[model samples]
Target: MTTWTYAELAPDFRYWLREGLPVGLPGVVAVSLDGGGHYARRFEDAPPALTVEATDFLLPLQPPVLYGDAQGLAVRLTDTGRAFDDCEVVFQAESPGFMLWTIHTGPLADANHVVRVPALPDGRAIRMISGVEVTCIENRDFADPTRPERTAVGASRR
Candidate 1:
């Protein structure tokens, strides 16, 4: 299994945080890591300064079920018909184990979108994205520990 250290991803994470991500949405910030790890935050209504509330996880990497990017390393879950209009689902692998994904809905669209990240089968922890420090936690920490039989050991997984 490949072990990932924060030192490797710190630069990219800091860069993303400083640039405010590449998201086109006005008040949404979304990021995903490899092994089914995804994070998203949407502000209620429209606020000048956004306070992010996020939900994230680490799960086994699954097949591309929805949308695949040009290189086939990224996949999205949004409908191809109204991708940019309503909501956006995106998952891109930055490197081998370093990946990021996003799901953003427009300001006028329904904000109740549900993102389900499968559980980590090896009982390891996944890293959380932060501007100042690097943090890692297990799937059981979130109060839900539904695990699979196999796990994908990415760079972020210890």
Candidate 2:
């Protein structure tokens, strides 16, 4: 019974997804679009959370996607190969030309991950795959206002 602002435009829209590994692991978290160069960061200790931008060019190529853990903290999409699944619209809000859409992929993940998506893509849409739940925020606003453009390698966002 949840409502989506953009659902009317694309009723079947679903957010992309990612897997959340246990904290403290050491590895590289990479994100990339079909043609765009990949962005990656290697960490000695896995971070508690991460955020990435769903560029306008790539978004138009596919439906939106999300994956959340417990604690209501949006996560990143670690794996983009998995197909989209049904989800529940937990929250939605209108914001001028854009909107905010939050969904629950299922029970809070074992890692207490969360993913926030503000917005989609097409026939073989330019997909974006990452190594972790993607949290899509409005392009006009910061992913986390308090930590604008701040990324703490191998640190926690708590």
RMSD of each: 17.5, 19.8
What TM value does model 2 have?
0.21
Residues forming the 10-long window of minimal summed lDDT in candidate 1: 148-157
Per-residue lDDT for 68-158 in model 1, tens only?
2332322223222211123334444323356464434342132223333332366333332411111222321122323211112112122
Tell me the TM-score of each prediction against the true structure.
Answer: 0.20, 0.21
Off by over 4 Å in 1: 1-18, 21-26, 45-55, 61-158
lDDT for every model?
A: 0.30, 0.32
Which segments of candidate 2 are over 4 A away from where they belong?
1-18, 54-158
Q: Which candidate is the best by lDDT?
A: 2
Compose the digit string of candidate 2's lDDT tens values, residues 1-158. Answer: 11111111122342222543334443444455443323343344556765656541223112223444342324343323332222233333333323344454542222223355433322221222332213222211222323222111111122
**Clash totals, every prediction:** 3, 30
10 residues in a row with least lDDT, candidate 2: 1-10
